[model samples]
Target chain A: MTGTSFIFWIVALLTVGSAAGVVFSKNLIYSAIALLFSLLGVAGLYVFLWADFIAVTQILIYVGGILVLIIFGIMLTHRITNVQLSHSSIQRGVGGVIVLVIFAGLSAMILNAPWHRSPAIEPLETVREIGRMLMINYLLPFEVASILLLAALMGAALLSRKTD
Target chain B: MVDLNTYLIIGAILFSLGMFGVITRRNGVAVLMGVELILNAANVNFVAFARFGGMDLTGHVFSLFVIILAAAEAAVALAIILNIFNNLGTVNIDEANQLKQ
Candidate 1:
Protein backbone atom coordinates (compact mmCIF):
# COMPACT_ATOMS: atom_id res chain seq x y z
CA MET A 1 0.00 0.00 0.00
CA THR A 2 1.05 3.56 -0.60
CA GLY A 3 1.79 5.84 2.33
CA THR A 4 -1.50 7.65 1.96
CA SER A 5 -3.47 4.43 1.86
CA PHE A 6 -1.60 3.12 4.86
CA ILE A 7 -2.31 6.26 6.81
CA PHE A 8 -5.94 6.10 5.80
CA TRP A 9 -6.22 2.51 6.97
CA ILE A 10 -4.53 3.30 10.28
CA VAL A 11 -6.75 6.27 10.98
CA ALA A 12 -9.82 4.35 9.90
CA LEU A 13 -8.98 1.52 12.30
CA LEU A 14 -8.33 3.91 15.16
CA THR A 15 -11.58 5.72 14.51
CA VAL A 16 -13.62 2.54 14.25
CA GLY A 17 -12.01 0.93 17.28
CA SER A 18 -12.41 3.96 19.48
CA ALA A 19 -15.98 4.39 18.29
CA ALA A 20 -16.75 0.82 19.22
CA GLY A 21 -15.15 1.40 22.58
CA VAL A 22 -17.34 4.43 23.12
CA VAL A 23 -20.40 2.25 22.72
CA PHE A 24 -19.12 -0.75 24.67
CA SER A 25 -17.49 1.00 27.61
CA LYS A 26 -19.49 0.90 30.80
CA ASN A 27 -17.67 3.71 32.57
CA LEU A 28 -18.82 7.00 31.24
CA ILE A 29 -15.37 8.46 31.76
CA TYR A 30 -13.83 5.70 29.70
CA SER A 31 -16.41 6.25 27.05
CA ALA A 32 -15.55 9.93 26.98
CA ILE A 33 -11.87 9.12 26.61
CA ALA A 34 -12.66 6.66 23.85
CA LEU A 35 -14.66 9.37 22.14
CA LEU A 36 -11.64 11.62 22.33
CA PHE A 37 -9.61 9.02 20.48
CA SER A 38 -12.35 8.60 17.95
CA LEU A 39 -12.50 12.33 17.38
CA LEU A 40 -8.75 12.49 16.95
CA GLY A 41 -8.93 9.70 14.44
CA VAL A 42 -11.60 11.58 12.54
CA ALA A 43 -9.32 14.59 12.53
CA GLY A 44 -6.68 12.41 10.99
CA LEU A 45 -9.18 11.40 8.36
CA TYR A 46 -9.89 15.06 7.72
CA VAL A 47 -6.20 15.69 7.19
CA PHE A 48 -6.09 12.73 4.83
CA LEU A 49 -8.90 14.33 2.90
CA TRP A 50 -6.93 17.61 2.70
CA ALA A 51 -9.20 19.50 5.08
CA ASP A 52 -6.63 21.01 7.42
CA PHE A 53 -9.00 23.61 8.80
CA ILE A 54 -11.74 21.13 9.62
CA ALA A 55 -9.24 18.74 11.20
CA VAL A 56 -7.97 21.39 13.56
CA THR A 57 -11.50 22.49 14.30
CA GLN A 58 -12.41 18.89 15.07
CA ILE A 59 -9.63 18.66 17.63
CA LEU A 60 -10.32 22.08 19.07
CA ILE A 61 -14.10 21.87 19.33
CA TYR A 62 -14.59 18.18 19.87
CA VAL A 63 -11.60 16.91 21.79
CA GLY A 64 -10.93 20.12 23.65
CA GLY A 65 -14.43 21.36 24.27
CA ILE A 66 -17.05 18.63 23.92
CA LEU A 67 -15.17 15.75 25.50
CA VAL A 68 -14.23 17.87 28.48
CA LEU A 69 -17.82 18.85 28.96
CA ILE A 70 -18.92 15.25 28.71
CA ILE A 71 -16.35 14.14 31.27
CA PHE A 72 -17.40 16.91 33.60
CA GLY A 73 -21.03 16.00 33.13
CA ILE A 74 -20.31 12.39 33.95
CA MET A 75 -18.40 13.37 37.07
CA LEU A 76 -21.09 15.74 38.19
CA THR A 77 -24.00 13.41 37.60
CA HIS A 78 -22.81 9.93 38.44
CA ARG A 79 -22.63 9.09 42.11
CA ILE A 80 -22.52 5.40 41.37
CA THR A 81 -19.36 3.42 40.89
CA ASN A 82 -18.10 2.84 37.36
CA VAL A 83 -18.75 -0.85 37.74
CA GLN A 84 -22.31 -0.21 38.70
CA LEU A 85 -22.94 1.63 35.44
CA SER A 86 -22.38 -1.52 33.45
CA HIS A 87 -25.48 -2.48 31.53
CA SER A 88 -27.09 -5.86 30.94
CA SER A 89 -26.33 -7.98 27.88
CA ILE A 90 -29.84 -7.43 26.63
CA GLN A 91 -29.26 -3.74 25.93
CA ARG A 92 -25.95 -4.39 24.23
CA GLY A 93 -27.34 -7.19 22.12
CA VAL A 94 -30.29 -5.20 20.93
CA GLY A 95 -28.20 -2.13 20.19
CA GLY A 96 -25.61 -4.18 18.38
CA VAL A 97 -28.17 -5.86 16.17
CA ILE A 98 -29.78 -2.59 15.20
CA VAL A 99 -26.48 -0.90 14.47
CA LEU A 100 -25.15 -3.84 12.51
CA VAL A 101 -28.27 -3.99 10.40
CA ILE A 102 -28.07 -0.30 9.60
CA PHE A 103 -24.39 -0.57 8.85
CA ALA A 104 -24.88 -3.51 6.54
CA GLY A 105 -27.59 -1.76 4.62
CA LEU A 106 -25.54 1.40 4.29
CA SER A 107 -22.48 -0.46 3.13
CA ALA A 108 -24.48 -2.40 0.59
CA MET A 109 -26.01 0.77 -0.76
CA ILE A 110 -22.70 2.56 -0.94
CA LEU A 111 -21.03 -0.36 -2.66
CA ASN A 112 -23.83 -0.73 -5.16
CA ALA A 113 -24.36 2.92 -5.97
CA PRO A 114 -22.90 4.36 -9.17
CA TRP A 115 -20.82 7.28 -7.99
CA HIS A 116 -20.12 9.71 -10.79
CA ARG A 117 -17.06 11.83 -10.24
CA SER A 118 -16.00 15.13 -11.72
CA PRO A 119 -12.27 15.21 -12.32
CA ALA A 120 -11.36 18.11 -10.11
CA ILE A 121 -9.28 16.51 -7.38
CA GLU A 122 -6.68 19.30 -7.52
CA PRO A 123 -7.28 20.13 -3.86
CA LEU A 124 -9.51 23.16 -4.26
CA GLU A 125 -8.77 26.09 -2.00
CA THR A 126 -11.84 25.28 0.03
CA VAL A 127 -10.87 26.94 3.28
CA ARG A 128 -9.93 30.24 1.68
CA GLU A 129 -12.63 30.29 -0.94
CA ILE A 130 -15.38 29.14 1.39
CA GLY A 131 -14.61 31.98 3.74
CA ARG A 132 -15.23 34.29 0.84
CA MET A 133 -18.41 32.51 -0.19
CA LEU A 134 -19.69 32.56 3.39
CA MET A 135 -19.42 36.30 3.40
CA ILE A 136 -20.88 36.74 -0.08
CA ASN A 137 -23.54 34.11 -0.80
CA TYR A 138 -24.16 32.47 2.57
CA LEU A 139 -23.87 35.60 4.67
CA LEU A 140 -27.44 35.54 5.90
CA PRO A 141 -27.29 31.95 7.12
CA PHE A 142 -23.91 32.63 8.67
CA GLU A 143 -25.27 35.52 10.67
CA VAL A 144 -28.34 33.54 11.60
CA ALA A 145 -26.20 30.71 12.89
CA SER A 146 -24.24 33.10 15.07
CA ILE A 147 -27.49 34.46 16.42
CA LEU A 148 -28.66 30.95 17.14
CA LEU A 149 -25.48 30.19 19.00
CA LEU A 150 -25.82 33.33 21.06
CA ALA A 151 -29.38 32.39 21.96
CA ALA A 152 -28.25 28.92 22.89
CA LEU A 153 -25.59 30.34 25.16
CA MET A 154 -28.09 32.53 26.89
CA GLY A 155 -30.56 29.69 27.32
CA ALA A 156 -27.85 27.43 28.68
CA ALA A 157 -26.74 30.01 31.20
CA LEU A 158 -30.28 30.51 32.34
CA LEU A 159 -30.90 26.79 32.66
CA SER A 160 -27.71 26.12 34.60
CA ARG A 161 -28.14 28.97 37.02
CA LYS A 162 -28.08 27.97 40.66
CA THR A 163 -31.23 29.33 42.25
CA ASP A 164 -30.05 30.47 45.61
CA MET B 1 -12.55 3.38 -6.94
CA VAL B 2 -10.36 5.38 -4.57
CA ASP B 3 -13.02 8.04 -4.26
CA LEU B 4 -16.07 9.29 -2.47
CA ASN B 5 -17.63 5.92 -1.83
CA THR B 6 -14.69 4.89 0.32
CA TYR B 7 -15.10 7.93 2.52
CA LEU B 8 -18.87 7.66 2.56
CA ILE B 9 -18.61 4.11 3.80
CA ILE B 10 -16.33 5.21 6.58
CA GLY B 11 -18.78 7.93 7.51
CA ALA B 12 -21.64 5.46 7.51
CA ILE B 13 -19.77 3.16 9.88
CA LEU B 14 -19.05 5.99 12.25
CA PHE B 15 -22.65 7.10 12.17
CA SER B 16 -23.80 3.56 12.87
CA LEU B 17 -21.49 3.35 15.87
CA GLY B 18 -22.89 6.63 17.11
CA MET B 19 -26.40 5.32 16.73
CA PHE B 20 -25.47 2.24 18.67
CA GLY B 21 -24.07 4.32 21.49
CA VAL B 22 -27.14 6.48 21.57
CA ILE B 23 -29.36 3.43 21.75
CA THR B 24 -27.51 1.46 24.40
CA ARG B 25 -25.81 3.93 26.70
CA ARG B 26 -27.52 4.84 29.92
CA ASN B 27 -25.68 8.11 30.45
CA GLY B 28 -27.11 11.20 28.85
CA VAL B 29 -23.66 12.69 28.34
CA ALA B 30 -22.57 9.56 26.49
CA VAL B 31 -25.62 9.83 24.32
CA LEU B 32 -24.65 13.39 23.48
CA MET B 33 -21.19 12.19 22.57
CA GLY B 34 -22.84 9.71 20.24
CA VAL B 35 -24.76 12.52 18.64
CA GLU B 36 -21.50 14.39 18.08
CA LEU B 37 -20.10 11.31 16.40
CA ILE B 38 -23.09 11.11 14.12
CA LEU B 39 -22.60 14.72 13.13
CA ASN B 40 -18.94 14.17 12.43
CA ALA B 41 -19.85 11.22 10.24
CA ALA B 42 -22.02 13.51 8.14
CA ASN B 43 -19.24 16.05 7.97
CA VAL B 44 -16.94 13.39 6.59
CA ASN B 45 -19.37 12.55 3.84
CA PHE B 46 -19.79 16.22 3.05
CA VAL B 47 -16.10 16.86 2.78
CA ALA B 48 -15.54 13.73 0.76
CA PHE B 49 -18.22 14.67 -1.69
CA ALA B 50 -16.85 18.17 -1.89
CA ARG B 51 -13.44 16.85 -2.71
CA PHE B 52 -14.33 14.20 -5.28
CA GLY B 53 -17.47 15.58 -6.83
CA GLY B 54 -16.05 19.04 -7.57
CA MET B 55 -18.91 20.89 -5.94
CA ASP B 56 -16.68 23.95 -5.53
CA LEU B 57 -16.30 23.79 -1.76
CA THR B 58 -20.00 24.01 -0.97
CA GLY B 59 -19.88 20.68 0.80
CA HIS B 60 -16.82 21.72 2.74
CA VAL B 61 -18.49 24.97 3.70
CA PHE B 62 -21.59 23.09 4.80
CA SER B 63 -19.43 20.83 6.91
CA LEU B 64 -17.84 23.86 8.53
CA PHE B 65 -21.26 25.14 9.52
CA VAL B 66 -22.17 21.72 10.78
CA ILE B 67 -19.10 21.64 13.00
CA ILE B 68 -19.88 25.02 14.46
CA LEU B 69 -23.46 23.98 15.07
CA ALA B 70 -22.34 20.77 16.71
CA ALA B 71 -20.09 22.69 19.08
CA ALA B 72 -22.91 25.00 19.98
CA GLU B 73 -25.15 22.03 20.48
CA ALA B 74 -22.70 20.27 22.76
CA ALA B 75 -22.27 23.34 24.86
CA VAL B 76 -25.99 23.84 25.27
CA ALA B 77 -26.65 20.14 25.82
CA LEU B 78 -23.95 19.89 28.44
CA ALA B 79 -25.41 22.86 30.23
CA ILE B 80 -28.79 21.18 30.21
CA ILE B 81 -27.21 17.99 31.44
CA LEU B 82 -25.68 19.94 34.32
CA ASN B 83 -29.03 21.45 35.11
CA ILE B 84 -30.62 18.04 35.10
CA PHE B 85 -27.95 16.72 37.40
CA ASN B 86 -28.47 19.56 39.83
CA ASN B 87 -32.18 18.77 39.88
CA LEU B 88 -32.34 14.99 39.54
CA GLY B 89 -28.85 13.93 40.70
CA THR B 90 -28.39 11.34 37.97
CA VAL B 91 -27.63 11.32 34.24
CA ASN B 92 -29.05 7.91 33.49
CA ILE B 93 -31.45 8.50 30.60
CA ASP B 94 -33.88 5.76 31.60
CA GLU B 95 -34.64 7.78 34.70
CA ALA B 96 -35.85 10.47 32.36
CA ASN B 97 -38.87 8.30 31.70
CA GLN B 98 -40.59 10.23 34.45
CA LEU B 99 -41.29 12.80 31.78
CA LYS B 100 -43.17 10.27 29.67
CA GLN B 101 -46.40 11.11 31.46
Candidate 2:
Protein backbone atom coordinates (compact mmCIF):
# COMPACT_ATOMS: atom_id res chain seq x y z
CA MET A 1 0.00 0.00 0.00
CA THR A 2 3.00 2.26 0.46
CA GLY A 3 4.51 4.09 -2.49
CA THR A 4 7.63 1.97 -2.45
CA SER A 5 5.64 -1.22 -2.27
CA PHE A 6 3.39 -0.05 -5.09
CA ILE A 7 6.33 0.70 -7.30
CA PHE A 8 7.94 -2.61 -6.46
CA TRP A 9 4.76 -4.53 -7.31
CA ILE A 10 4.34 -2.76 -10.64
CA VAL A 11 7.94 -3.33 -11.62
CA ALA A 12 7.75 -6.94 -10.49
CA LEU A 13 4.64 -7.54 -12.60
CA LEU A 14 6.23 -6.04 -15.70
CA THR A 15 9.41 -8.04 -15.18
CA VAL A 16 7.53 -11.30 -14.69
CA GLY A 17 5.14 -10.68 -17.59
CA SER A 18 7.82 -9.84 -20.13
CA ALA A 19 9.95 -12.73 -18.90
CA ALA A 20 7.01 -15.07 -19.50
CA GLY A 21 6.59 -13.59 -22.95
CA VAL A 22 10.25 -14.19 -23.61
CA VAL A 23 9.63 -17.86 -22.90
CA PHE A 24 6.17 -18.32 -24.44
CA SER A 25 5.97 -15.92 -27.36
CA LYS A 26 5.95 -17.56 -30.76
CA ASN A 27 7.58 -14.89 -32.87
CA LEU A 28 11.29 -14.80 -32.22
CA ILE A 29 11.51 -11.10 -32.92
CA TYR A 30 8.63 -10.34 -30.58
CA SER A 31 10.29 -12.44 -27.94
CA ALA A 32 13.50 -10.48 -28.35
CA ILE A 33 11.64 -7.21 -28.01
CA ALA A 34 9.82 -8.59 -25.00
CA LEU A 35 13.21 -9.40 -23.55
CA LEU A 36 14.15 -5.76 -23.91
CA PHE A 37 11.12 -4.79 -21.89
CA SER A 38 11.95 -7.42 -19.33
CA LEU A 39 15.49 -6.10 -19.07
CA LEU A 40 14.19 -2.59 -18.59
CA GLY A 41 11.90 -3.78 -15.85
CA VAL A 42 14.84 -5.38 -14.07
CA ALA A 43 16.78 -2.15 -14.34
CA GLY A 44 13.93 -0.28 -12.77
CA LEU A 45 13.85 -2.78 -9.95
CA TYR A 46 17.54 -2.18 -9.43
CA VAL A 47 16.80 1.51 -9.05
CA PHE A 48 14.12 0.75 -6.50
CA LEU A 49 16.65 -1.27 -4.56
CA TRP A 50 19.03 1.75 -4.49
CA ALA A 51 21.53 0.26 -6.92
CA ASP A 52 21.78 3.09 -9.40
CA PHE A 53 25.05 1.87 -10.86
CA ILE A 54 23.66 -1.60 -11.40
CA ALA A 55 20.50 -0.17 -12.95
CA VAL A 56 22.57 1.87 -15.36
CA THR A 57 24.83 -1.05 -16.21
CA GLN A 58 21.81 -3.29 -16.71
CA ILE A 59 20.38 -0.81 -19.22
CA LEU A 60 23.67 -0.32 -20.99
CA ILE A 61 24.80 -3.94 -21.23
CA TYR A 62 21.53 -5.82 -21.41
CA VAL A 63 19.15 -3.49 -23.19
CA GLY A 64 21.78 -1.84 -25.34
CA GLY A 65 24.35 -4.52 -26.14
CA ILE A 66 22.91 -7.97 -25.54
CA LEU A 67 19.43 -7.22 -26.84
CA VAL A 68 20.89 -5.79 -30.02
CA LEU A 69 22.96 -8.91 -30.49
CA ILE A 70 19.86 -11.05 -30.02
CA ILE A 71 17.93 -9.01 -32.56
CA PHE A 72 20.76 -9.31 -35.06
CA GLY A 73 20.93 -13.03 -34.46
CA ILE A 74 17.21 -13.30 -35.09
CA MET A 75 17.60 -11.38 -38.32
CA LEU A 76 20.57 -13.42 -39.48
CA THR A 77 18.91 -16.72 -38.68
CA HIS A 78 16.49 -17.97 -41.33
CA ARG A 79 13.56 -19.06 -39.20
CA ILE A 80 12.94 -15.60 -37.76
CA THR A 81 11.90 -14.13 -41.08
CA ASN A 82 9.09 -16.63 -41.53
CA VAL A 83 5.81 -16.12 -39.68
CA GLN A 84 5.71 -19.75 -38.54
CA LEU A 85 8.15 -19.40 -35.68
CA SER A 86 5.63 -20.43 -33.08
CA HIS A 87 6.10 -23.34 -30.69
CA SER A 88 3.64 -26.18 -30.27
CA SER A 89 0.78 -26.16 -27.74
CA ILE A 90 2.13 -29.34 -26.20
CA GLN A 91 5.48 -27.76 -25.41
CA ARG A 92 3.69 -24.81 -23.87
CA GLY A 93 1.58 -27.02 -21.63
CA VAL A 94 4.54 -29.00 -20.41
CA GLY A 95 6.74 -25.94 -19.92
CA GLY A 96 3.91 -24.21 -18.15
CA VAL A 97 3.51 -27.01 -15.59
CA ILE A 98 7.20 -27.28 -14.93
CA VAL A 99 7.72 -23.53 -14.56
CA LEU A 100 4.67 -23.18 -12.29
CA VAL A 101 5.80 -25.88 -9.93
CA ILE A 102 9.27 -24.44 -9.76
CA PHE A 103 7.91 -20.97 -9.14
CA ALA A 104 5.68 -22.23 -6.34
CA GLY A 105 8.52 -24.02 -4.63
CA LEU A 106 10.85 -21.04 -4.89
CA SER A 107 8.21 -18.63 -3.72
CA ALA A 108 7.52 -20.76 -0.70
CA MET A 109 11.17 -20.97 0.17
CA ILE A 110 11.69 -17.23 -0.19
CA LEU A 111 8.57 -16.30 1.77
CA ASN A 112 9.25 -18.74 4.56
CA ALA A 113 12.91 -17.83 5.07
CA PRO A 114 13.68 -15.51 7.97
CA TRP A 115 15.84 -12.85 6.39
CA HIS A 116 17.53 -10.59 8.95
CA ARG A 117 18.79 -7.19 7.94
CA SER A 118 22.04 -6.10 9.54
CA PRO A 119 21.25 -3.06 11.65
CA ALA A 120 24.76 -1.75 12.15
CA ILE A 121 25.58 -1.18 8.52
CA GLU A 122 24.76 2.18 7.02
CA PRO A 123 23.43 2.90 3.52
CA LEU A 124 26.62 2.86 1.49
CA GLU A 125 26.79 4.46 -1.92
CA THR A 126 28.96 1.80 -3.47
CA VAL A 127 30.39 3.43 -6.58
CA ARG A 128 33.53 4.92 -5.08
CA GLU A 129 34.20 2.04 -2.73
CA ILE A 130 33.55 -0.47 -5.47
CA GLY A 131 35.95 1.36 -7.72
CA ARG A 132 38.54 1.30 -5.01
CA MET A 133 37.95 -2.35 -4.31
CA LEU A 134 38.09 -3.22 -7.97
CA MET A 135 41.42 -1.48 -8.14
CA ILE A 136 42.75 -2.90 -4.91
CA ASN A 137 41.27 -6.00 -3.22
CA TYR A 138 39.36 -7.43 -6.19
CA LEU A 139 41.81 -6.27 -8.83
CA LEU A 140 42.77 -9.71 -9.98
CA PRO A 141 39.26 -10.97 -10.58
CA PHE A 142 38.38 -7.77 -12.38
CA GLU A 143 41.26 -8.11 -14.80
CA VAL A 144 40.54 -11.80 -15.28
CA ALA A 145 36.94 -11.10 -16.17
CA SER A 146 38.06 -8.63 -18.80
CA ILE A 147 40.48 -11.17 -20.20
CA LEU A 148 37.72 -13.75 -20.31
CA LEU A 149 35.53 -11.33 -22.22
CA LEU A 150 38.26 -10.77 -24.75
CA ALA A 151 38.64 -14.50 -25.20
CA ALA A 152 34.92 -14.89 -25.65
CA LEU A 153 34.92 -12.18 -28.29
CA MET A 154 37.68 -13.93 -30.22
CA GLY A 155 35.91 -17.23 -29.89
CA ALA A 156 32.65 -15.77 -31.17
CA ALA A 157 34.34 -14.34 -34.22
CA LEU A 158 36.11 -17.59 -34.91
CA LEU A 159 32.92 -19.58 -34.63
CA SER A 160 30.92 -17.24 -36.82
CA ARG A 161 33.42 -17.09 -39.66
CA LYS A 162 32.56 -18.80 -42.93
CA THR A 163 34.71 -21.85 -43.44
CA ASP A 164 36.10 -22.77 -46.85
CA MET B 1 6.99 -7.74 5.78
CA VAL B 2 7.55 -6.14 2.34
CA ASP B 3 11.22 -6.84 2.53
CA LEU B 4 13.86 -8.81 0.67
CA ASN B 5 11.71 -11.88 0.26
CA THR B 6 9.49 -10.12 -2.23
CA TYR B 7 12.44 -9.29 -4.45
CA LEU B 8 13.91 -12.76 -4.00
CA ILE B 9 10.63 -14.36 -5.02
CA ILE B 10 10.43 -12.18 -8.07
CA GLY B 11 13.96 -13.18 -8.89
CA ALA B 12 13.06 -16.82 -8.47
CA ILE B 13 10.12 -16.45 -10.84
CA LEU B 14 12.28 -14.80 -13.46
CA PHE B 15 14.92 -17.50 -13.12
CA SER B 16 12.28 -20.22 -13.49
CA LEU B 17 10.80 -18.64 -16.59
CA GLY B 18 14.28 -18.57 -18.09
CA MET B 19 14.74 -22.21 -17.17
CA PHE B 20 11.46 -23.07 -18.85
CA GLY B 21 12.53 -21.21 -21.96
CA VAL B 22 15.85 -23.00 -22.06
CA ILE B 23 14.15 -26.38 -21.72
CA THR B 24 11.32 -26.00 -24.24
CA ARG B 25 12.55 -23.60 -26.90
CA ARG B 26 13.96 -25.05 -30.09
CA ASN B 27 16.06 -22.19 -31.35
CA GLY B 28 19.58 -21.88 -30.02
CA VAL B 29 19.29 -18.09 -29.96
CA ALA B 30 16.11 -18.30 -27.92
CA VAL B 31 17.83 -20.62 -25.51
CA LEU B 32 20.52 -17.98 -25.09
CA MET B 33 17.84 -15.45 -24.33
CA GLY B 34 16.54 -17.79 -21.64
CA VAL B 35 19.99 -17.96 -20.16
CA GLU B 36 20.19 -14.16 -20.12
CA LEU B 37 16.92 -14.01 -18.24
CA ILE B 38 18.28 -16.39 -15.65
CA LEU B 39 21.42 -14.31 -15.22
CA ASN B 40 19.42 -11.13 -14.82
CA ALA B 41 17.37 -12.80 -12.13
CA ALA B 42 20.56 -13.55 -10.23
CA ASN B 43 21.66 -9.96 -10.67
CA VAL B 44 18.41 -8.81 -9.12
CA ASN B 45 19.03 -10.93 -6.07
CA PHE B 46 22.57 -9.61 -5.80
CA VAL B 47 21.41 -6.02 -5.85
CA ALA B 48 18.63 -6.71 -3.40
CA PHE B 49 20.92 -8.36 -0.91
CA ALA B 50 23.44 -5.59 -1.34
CA ARG B 51 20.87 -3.00 -0.44
CA PHE B 52 18.91 -4.53 2.44
CA GLY B 53 21.01 -7.21 4.01
CA GLY B 54 24.66 -6.43 3.61
CA MET B 55 24.24 -2.69 3.12
CA ASP B 56 27.51 -2.78 1.23
CA LEU B 57 28.22 -1.98 -2.37
CA THR B 58 29.90 -5.32 -3.05
CA GLY B 59 26.68 -6.89 -4.26
CA HIS B 60 26.09 -4.02 -6.66
CA VAL B 61 29.63 -4.25 -7.93
CA PHE B 62 29.30 -8.00 -8.35
CA SER B 63 26.09 -7.45 -10.29
CA LEU B 64 27.90 -5.08 -12.61
CA PHE B 65 30.47 -7.75 -13.30
CA VAL B 66 27.64 -10.20 -13.86
CA ILE B 67 25.98 -7.89 -16.39
CA ILE B 68 29.20 -7.65 -18.35
CA LEU B 69 29.65 -11.40 -18.29
CA ALA B 70 26.09 -11.88 -19.50
CA ALA B 71 26.76 -9.57 -22.43
CA ALA B 72 29.85 -11.51 -23.39
CA GLU B 73 27.95 -14.74 -22.92
CA ALA B 74 25.14 -13.64 -25.21
CA ALA B 75 27.54 -12.58 -27.90
CA VAL B 76 29.38 -15.90 -27.86
CA ALA B 77 26.21 -17.94 -27.60
CA LEU B 78 24.54 -16.06 -30.45
CA ALA B 79 27.59 -16.54 -32.60
CA ILE B 80 27.45 -20.26 -31.95
CA ILE B 81 23.75 -20.31 -32.72
CA LEU B 82 24.39 -18.52 -35.99
CA ASN B 83 26.96 -21.10 -36.93
CA ILE B 84 24.54 -23.87 -36.08
CA PHE B 85 21.83 -22.26 -38.16
CA ASN B 86 24.18 -21.83 -41.09
CA ASN B 87 25.24 -25.45 -41.02
CA LEU B 88 21.96 -27.17 -40.19
CA GLY B 89 19.51 -24.99 -42.16
CA THR B 90 17.33 -24.96 -39.03
CA VAL B 91 17.76 -23.95 -35.39
CA ASN B 92 15.49 -26.62 -34.01
CA ILE B 93 17.09 -28.73 -31.27
CA ASP B 94 15.36 -31.86 -32.47
CA GLU B 95 16.84 -31.37 -35.94
CA ALA B 96 20.34 -31.18 -34.50
CA ASN B 97 20.03 -34.46 -32.62
CA GLN B 98 22.67 -36.36 -34.55
CA LEU B 99 24.34 -37.41 -31.31
CA LYS B 100 21.21 -39.15 -30.11
CA GLN B 101 21.21 -41.73 -32.89
Q: Can you list each candidate's DockQ?
A: 0.70, 0.71
lDDT of 1 by residue, A31-75 (tens): 778889999999998888778878888888888887887777766
TM-score of chain B of each: 0.94, 0.92
Model 2: per-residue lDDT, tens digit, A22-116? 98897787898899999999999988887777788888888889999988887788644477665432377788788889889888888788887
- Highest DockQ among the candidates is held by which one? 2
TM-score for the A chain of candidate 1? 0.89
RMSD score of candidate 1 (Å)? 2.1
Every model: iRMSD? 1.8, 1.9
RMSD of each: 2.1, 2.0
Model 2 scores a C-alpha lDDT of 0.84
**TM-score for each model:** 0.92, 0.92
Alpha-carbon deviation at A82 in model 2, angstroms: 2.6
Docking class of 2: medium
